[model samples]
Each structure stands twice: as C-alpha cells, then as structure tokens.
Target: MNAKPTEATLADRHVLYQESVQDVEAEIDFVQETFQALRGRDAELLREDFCGTANTACEWIRRGRAHRAIGVDLDADVLQWGIDNNLARLSAEQRGRIELLQQDVLTVKTDAPDMILAMNFSYYLFLGRDELRSYFRNARLSLKDDGILFLDAFGGYEAPMELEEPRECEGFDYIWDQASFNPINNQMTCHIHFEFEDGSRMDKAFSYHWRLWSLPEIREVLYEAGFRQVDIYWEGTDEETEEGNGIYEPSEVGDADPGWICYIVAEK
Candidate 1:
C-alpha cells in the first residue's frame, strides 16, 4: 500500500478539503429533487462530473437502493483518495456497485445515466461559450433517455471582485475568497484558504478561473443543447439572520444579490 501523504500545513493547502459522503448528501438531495420536479419521476442513475474524491458519487449510492453512480474526473490522485476515504464508508454491496474512473469528463466514454451533477462549480474550469456548450452537449449525450443535468451556480450583482470571508466549521474555519472579478466580460478568479489553530494560515490553496455565466445564459445553452426544460432552484435566506440558510427552494424569482448561490436543473 502507498503511504498516506502528510496533511498539508496551513501554508500549503492544495488539498483544501477532505470531504466524505455525508458532506455531499446535502447537494445530492437538491439535485434529485430538482430532477424529479421536472421529470415527475425519481432518478436512478447518477453521473458525477469532475467528481473530485468521488464524495458525491458515494453519497448518491446511499440515497436509495436502486441508485447507481459513476464518478468521472481527470485526477487519479483524488480517485485514489476517494477509494481511501469516501469508498470505505460504503457497504460491501454499495462499494462494488459504484464505479470511479480517472479521465477527462469531456472525453470519457460510458453509458448515460439518469442525471449528471456538476457540483462545487467544477464546470467553471471551462472558460468559453463553445467549450462549455460542448460540455453541456456531451452531458446531454451521456444521459439516459430521460436523464437530466444538474449544476450548482453562484453569482450576483457584485460577483467579479476581490473579497474574503470566513465561516465557522465543526473544528476549523472555512474561508471563501473572491480573489478577482472582471466586469468587462464577467471573468472571475477565486480561491479557498484555510486558517487553523496555533495561528497558522494557508492562502491560495485551490484557485478557480471561471466565466461568471448568468442564469439566463446557461438556461439558453441548456435549451440549445436540446434539454426539454430548465429550472432554477433559488436559495432562501434565514428569516432572522438574513443570511443564506443553506436551504434551497424552487422558484423563478432569481434576482440580483450581493452574493447568491443556486442550482440549475435541465431535463432531456
């Protein structure tokens, strides 16, 4: 067996997070609900795009007994990490049922599933209309006859700008920093940094260079890609705190906000 790599110190955090199945269930529930809402049926097969560590794939398996999942990513290191971390949490049957592959999601050849989920803004890695459209088309092709595609998107009035904020987690702090945003074309750059006890700090652990695509624009692309329908699941703020309370409800009143996050579900 290969030795485990040392946990990166605060100064070096390319591995910004070590997620497991539970961490991804929250997102999977939203994806599944959105798919059912549109198709009027439950999804059975799920394909996870850019499935780093395959956390969501493992979680999908647990959502129901009939559920199956395929996790596709280009990084073999994280594939192995998933086997080491997330896959262990699965039952023997679930472990054998789910499949994890290391390949470019854009070119991967496999059977279509009921739904494809692109979570954590992973699609943001692609920075062009043509490239993104190609990916969306590929996703459509990779879906089962009645499958849908689900993606989580975030942006608002002031998306392309440098900003930093911290959140409290169970034991550590989670920080999402908007390192740069360009108003000219909605090109944006962001980073995830972590601060630990003992006054240790890690900066620029993981960076993303993404085109800040709008809801209408993405929906248009989904329609162009042949999806029969597209729906937006807007985020709801906590009544008392006026902060995003982590619960998302289906709605079309997706308006501008200082910062907002929501899901876009497309049906085929």
Candidate 2:
C-alpha cells in the first residue's frame, strides 16, 4: 500500500525555496568583497530590489552595526513574512537598521545606497526594452555617485528548452519547469514545483513570465541608463570537482556551457 499524500503548506514552500535556491551568506560575501576590490572601501548601505522574503537584506544587516539595508518589493504579504521570520531572527539593533518597503522598485525613493542588488534574475520580469531601461535608469539614480549595481543573469542553450528538471533535496524534490518558450520574442514561462516524500506535490508554487534578455542587451541598457562602467564576473570551475567553485572573477569572455549564471556589475 502507498503512503497517504500530505499537502504542503506555504511555509513549506518558503523553506524549500530558501534551502534549494538561496545562499544569502555567500551572496553578501561576494557583494562585500567585490565592492571593496573596486572602490577601495566597504559598502555600507544596500538596497535589495525585488527582495521577496528579504533574506539577503537580513543578512546584509547582520554583517555589522555600520551596515544598513533596504528591501523593496510590491508584495505586502511576502514582506510581512520576511519581517516575521527573517527579521525576527536578527538582533534588535540589526533589525533597526533594515527597512522593508512595499513599493514598486522603479518609483520608490530612498537615500542613495552604496550597492543595489537584483539577484535571482528578478529583473527579467520587465519584459520590454523600455521598461527594463527605465528600471536601470531608476536604479542608477538611486545609487551614490560611486555606487554599484549588482545583477545576476542566467542563460545558455538549455535555458529555452521546454523541459522540467528535478533534483532531490533532503525532504523533497525541487523541480524547475520550463513550461513554454517562444523563440520569436524570447518570452519564457517557468514554474517551481515541489514533490514531497509522501507523494504529495505542489505544482506552480511560483511562476515567472519573463523575457529572457541576452547579455549584450542587458549591457547596452545599463550603458544607456548612464552607468559609467559595466563588468562581468564569471564563475570559476573547480579543477578537482569539475563544477562551479563559488569563486567569481572579472572576465571579458565566458565558456559556452549548456547552462551558466554570471553577475553584471554596473558602476554609476
């Protein structure tokens, strides 16, 4: 006889997403190290655009008393969840240094931050060239004169394929479904699904309708938005393991792998 199916909860989805996708500590470390290398000083203020649960912002504040973070998103419910969960785990002083705003990233105004991050490819939600350029312009304006914008992007031959890939985690199977792709416009629809051990599954727990932007397109927009310089950080492959070593260095060329992710640093 088969075991009974257990329905997963929203909390389960969040936990799985974080465990499977985010490395907040590593991300902050990269931001700090990269900024120091470029500017000869540490970055103090950070703005995480499309912050979702604000995990990155929470980690940013935990770095030091001098560090302050701002998380901007349009989803009030998700922002509240971050406050209740991630923020609640921080010390009062650390929590005091972070702010969450339920506002559009393009229109929200704040003090110029030393670094602005758009990780997880959230900026892909802007499907039009005009909208994306507008966003880059707004982001540039929100930064200090020496500030840098950090954005992550993924692409390769496999990205446009309509297929689902599953990886087994500790308690569940994480599924990345590429539901549909339109080659004409580069519009792609993707979803995140989870299957539990008890045969229960959550389909489309998170869905994204994005226009896959190429690296050249993104770089041109950033330049048009008034960024003084744009640099690409390519991940290094480990010789022993034949996998990404989590070490990224500035590069002008990247390998033609089946799939890859890299960071674009735009200086204002």
The best candidate by lDDT is: 2
TM-score of each model, paired residue for residue: 0.88, 0.96
Instruction: Give Cα distance to truth, residue 121, candidate 2, Å.
Output: 0.3
Cα lDDT tens digits for candidate 2, 79-187: 9989988999999889889999999998989999999999999999999999999999999999999999999999989999999999998888899999999999999
Candidate 2 deviation (Cα RMSD): 2.0
- Residue-wise lDDT of candidate 1 within 190-221, one digit each (tens)? 88777666556666667788888887888888
Q: How many clashes (backbone N, Cα, C below 3 Å) per candidate? A: 1, 0
lDDT of 2 at 87: 93
Clashes of 2: 0
